[model samples]
Target: MPGEYGYPNLNDNDWIWGGTLTDIETTLTHGIRWEGSDATRVNYMPAFDGMFDAGQVAALTSHVLSLSGKAKPNATGAVLFTENCAACHGATGAGLPAMGAPALNDAIWLYGGSEAAVRKQILAPRHGVMPGWKDRLDPATIKMLAAYVHSRGGGQQAAPAAEPATDVAQAPMAETDG
Candidate 1:
């Protein structure tokens, strides 16, 4: 259920952008890489066609497959993964939600999970686009849609807000001795 055609399968818990209500609403409003909207959720994985040779591409592909335990791990692939793919996809291929990178360590994949499919993607990355409903649909409709999607079993809670940093220099003096 992870891969639905070329797009991500919503039936599962793996969320590329996010599964929270707010996150879902934002995606529904702006869309993913939709050119029609300025606020589209955009993240592009660069094609390694010209960047690396065929051997290197194969190594990278092998590495990706190995992440999900689909193939045997290779030293060449590990080195390539560390040097090239670790920034966004993460060192362990766990993925970074803020960067819109999917977890490669898991069996889930946006596209097909075959070795050939992985190789093709690494060679010439395929980017999917979702249309924004702000221009066509009313705000109420969008909100309702978001709610519906959030009700699905895969929905996730929003991340907690970061704690505010304390200003050590602004500490108040204690009056206990007075």
Candidate 2:
């Protein structure tokens, strides 16, 4: 809402990933689609323009909207969803954390959640990317930021103590500059 690629508010319980401190910490260390870290997370929802016809996409949008009870469930959409979306969004539309799919049943949307918006997303999905903070902040600082995020009340239980941020090893230097 803040910008073209702005992230959602942190205070909400709707986490793309899980809400655990470790989970948030992991996300912070290696952002979504971030190329900076070896452990960086990435999930891509391919556009459906080539995959489905316009009518199918509209029907799929109808089904997705129906997951939240916003629209009547059309057989066409439901069938498409069952065959396609259910794997990641789940049979009940409860999104999978591992797959980075947001729950469609929930009204909370990172992007606009209108029917048209849904259809557009089906046609050309948005692969939201979150930048990693490892290069910008030290491990301890990252943990502190995590703690602050935890204080926002959406945070889950903390995981066991683990090392932070410095997952990748330095690349070997090549003798080039003379």
Candidate 3:
């Protein structure tokens, strides 16, 4: 189960970053928000304590719950979510793997799924940090770890390769982490 101690579940498809072999390798090498590694995958969801009032937070929480069919939908919550969360979580709350954002439309949640849990998270989000193992483990060991993790039931297939451009004038855009 996820959120047992702020760590994600490796056995489920609701990956916060991604579930590919390469993605797992990268995460194990640099870690997620690890202070020791400059290449650590990092992204922060700003705390909304000061940004929203009690009622507003409740509305937003309800809206988030509604995404997973756990609560009644709130129009104000929808607007608030669009204005504040769409950039990273996507317009439909599907999430962006590149941005390390978790999908909210699914029933799978990193944290608890209750109304109170959602409200607390809305007020003050918690960000988990995973330490990099590159310094502590050899490349082969890391590869093995990646392999083991990839064998989990939730592991995803590698993304399809992009087609090469025939036009020299057209160059592939560089993708950057958020």
Ranking by lDDT: 3, 1, 2
Candidate 2 positional error at 74, Å = 1.5
Q: Looking at model 3, how many pairs of residues clash?
A: 0
How many clashing pairs per prediction, in order? 0, 0, 0
lDDT of predicted model 2: 0.74
Candidate topping lDDT: 3
lDDT of each: 0.78, 0.74, 0.79
Pairs of residues at least 3 apart in sequence or in different chains that clash in candidate 2 = none
Clashes of 2: 0
For each of the candidates, the C-alpha root-mean-square deviation to the true structure, in angstroms, is 9.8, 11.2, 5.7
lDDT, residue 120, model 3? 79
> What TM-scores do the predictions have?
0.85, 0.83, 0.86
Query: What does candidate 2's lDDT look like per residue over 19-104, in tens digits?
Result: 78888899999988998888988768777688888788888988889888898989998878877776666666766666677788
What's model 3's overall lDDT? Answer: 0.79
* Candidate 1 residue runs with Cα over 4 Å from true position: 1-3, 161-178
lDDT of 1 by residue, 1-178 (tens): 3456778877778878878888899999999999989989888998878888888888888888988898899889888887777666767787756667788888787788898999888888899889999999999999999988777668998758722212211221211100
lDDT of 1 at 113: 84
* Arranged by TM-score, best first: 3, 1, 2
Which one is best on TM-score?
Answer: 3
